[model samples]
Target chain A: QQQVKQSPQSLIVQKGGISIINCAYENTAFDYFPWYQQFPGKGPALLIAIRPDVSEKKEGRFTISFNKSAKQFSLHIMDSQPGDSATYFCAASMEASYDKVIFGPGTSLSVIP
Target chain B: DAGITQSPRHKVTETGTPVTLRCHQTENHRYMYWYRQDPGHGLRLIHYSYGVKDTDKGEVSDGYSVSRSKTEDFLLTLESATSSQTSVYFCAISRVTRGEQYFGPGTRLTVT
Candidate 1:
């Protein structure tokens, strides 16, 4: 069973446009939600993260909007650039499980100039 | 870069053969993890260690074994290679269980 589910297996956006990817989790025990970005032939890197306590968190052009009650979270990239093209993964983990994260399949994003 | 390195970045072996991958870290982190990434499957944890000589199985641990005898090194071994085990393996380190995890470049393994 995929505990975490992500929408839009892939996405394409134009430069200067907004790019969004959504994710949802079935386990209410999840407390920490994080997003990772990966470039070709490299490992995934931490992009942004949020906790259930906060409804939203923003850093630079990346923002994570989380809804605890809905068990959903979304990532928004403002003014998407061609350089932003990469794969994004959303993950969830609870403190009790030693922070063993469960990740969504992934969303491949492409920003065209 | 968290000072993590994965040896044998690429490997190819035949079925029934044994394969081992190495992950080394200089960050002195207390936690280390091994994960496998595949298309449409995201990343699945194979094993993790919280301290030297302490390890735990992850969601997908079948046919896999791990060891952490030293703080700077963690190893993942495939008892007997199988085609189903082919995938990109990644090692991650964190200062604490809930802290941010830093990932190594990755090792692409192929079992024929």
Candidate 2:
């Protein structure tokens, strides 16, 4: 079973437009939600993360909106640029000792300049 | 960004041959994980270790094995490599007090 599901396997957006990627989780026990960005031939790096207690988190051009009741979370990139093009993965981890994170299939986003 | 490294960045082996990939971290993180990435499929966890000599299997641990004898080293071994096992493998390390993990450059393994 896929613990986390992501939609829109691929997406393209104008340079100045907003790029959105959505994810949903089945395990309600998950408290930490994080989004990772990975470029070709590179390992994934943490972009933004949010706790269930907060509804939204914004770090510069990246934003993460969380919904506890809906068990859903989405990533929004403002004023997308070609540099922002990469594969994004959404992950969930419960507040436990191990904190084993389960990741989504991932969404490939491209920003055309 | 952490000091994580995977040795033998690229390797090719024949079917039925044993292959081992090494992951080394300089930060001495307590938590280390091994995952395999393939086309269409996202990263799938193979194994993870919470502490030296403490390890557990993950979703795709059937044909893989891991060992962590020290805090900074983890090894993933394929008893008998198969063509289906060809993929990019990543190693990640995270400290107990840290929320985010740091991944190594990755190892590209191919079995023909």
The candidate maximizing DockQ is 1
Which ten contiguous residues of candidate 1 chain B have the minimum total lDDT? B93-102
lDDT of 2: 0.88
What tens-digit string does per-residue lDDT give for candidate 1 at B15-104? 999999999999788889999999999999999998999999999999999999999999999999999999999999976545367899
| B1-112 per-residue lDDT for model 2 (tens digits) | 7899999999999999999999999987888999899877788889989999999998899889989998889999999999999999999987652346678989999999
When summed lDDT is taken over every stretch of 10 residues in candidate 2 chain A, the lowest stretch is: A92-101
Give the distance in Å from residue B44's predicted Cα in candidate 1 to where it truly belongs: 0.3
Candidate DockQ values, in order, are 0.67, 0.57
Q: What is the DockQ of candidate 2?
A: 0.57
Q: Give all candidates' CA lDDT scores.
A: 0.92, 0.88
Backbone clash pairs for candidate 2 read none
Question: In DockQ, how does model 1 score against the reference complex?
Answer: 0.67
Choose the strongest candidate by lDDT: 1
Clashing pairs in 1: none
Model 2: residues with Cα > 4 Å off, grouped in runs: A97-99, B97-99
